[model samples]
Target: MGDHFFRKLWQGTAPLVLWASHFFFCYLYAASGCRRETWAVLLGATLLALAGAGWLAWKAWRGGGEASLGVLHMARLGGAILALAAIAWSAMPLLVFGRCG
Candidate 1:
């Protein structure tokens, strides 16, 4: 029971956590100094976050089963989707500005 609870907790929160971490890293990196490598770092972080969120969403979608688990999986799916959107949105400034301003 404890393991199951923890697993569910991870599934529901992991994507958001990844998104938040990526957001933090981007700002921190940009603030440190907009070096020539800044774009590369941001791009890498964005791709990694997107991949993580996508994988979580896929897992949530594929893990669906029993009625009781449906809600939990749905929550996981929703969180993953939200994270995906947030991460993409957060990366937009990099694309639009094309450099630290």
Candidate 2:
């Protein structure tokens, strides 16, 4: 039961988890009044999340079965791309918000 649960969990959820975490942090930082230090923290966190997403994408691309065209593999790739886009969207505010309020 334990192994089966874990196997299903790891099938293709890395990007989703990372995206949620990134969203939470970005929201927290923004709601903090966008302090001077928020820029540093936000940039750092975004970069770190981007790196993680990139890693997951690489793994998804390489870990497929002998069969090159599979639904699960394509889904993982799509998820990774969506995650990257979400991270970029969240990072955009850093440039839009002129300064601390």
Provide C-alpha RMSD values for all models, in order. Answer: 1.8, 2.0
- Residue-level lDDT tens digits of model 1 in 8-100: 788778888999999999999888997888888899999989999999988878777774367777788899999999999999988998964
Clashing pairs in 1: none
Model 2 lDDT tens row, 1-101: 99975764665677978989999988987787766787888888999999999888888888777744776677677788889889989888878874564
lDDT of 1: 0.88
Q: Whole-model Cα lDDT per candidate? A: 0.88, 0.82
Q: lDDT of candidate 2 vs native? A: 0.82
Off by over 4 Å in 2: 98-101
Measured by lDDT, the strongest candidate is 1
- Kindly report which residue stretches of model 1 are placed more than 4 angstroms away from their true locations once superposed: none
* Candidate 2 residue pairs in backbone clash: none
Worst ten-residue run, lDDT, model 1?
Answer: 63-72
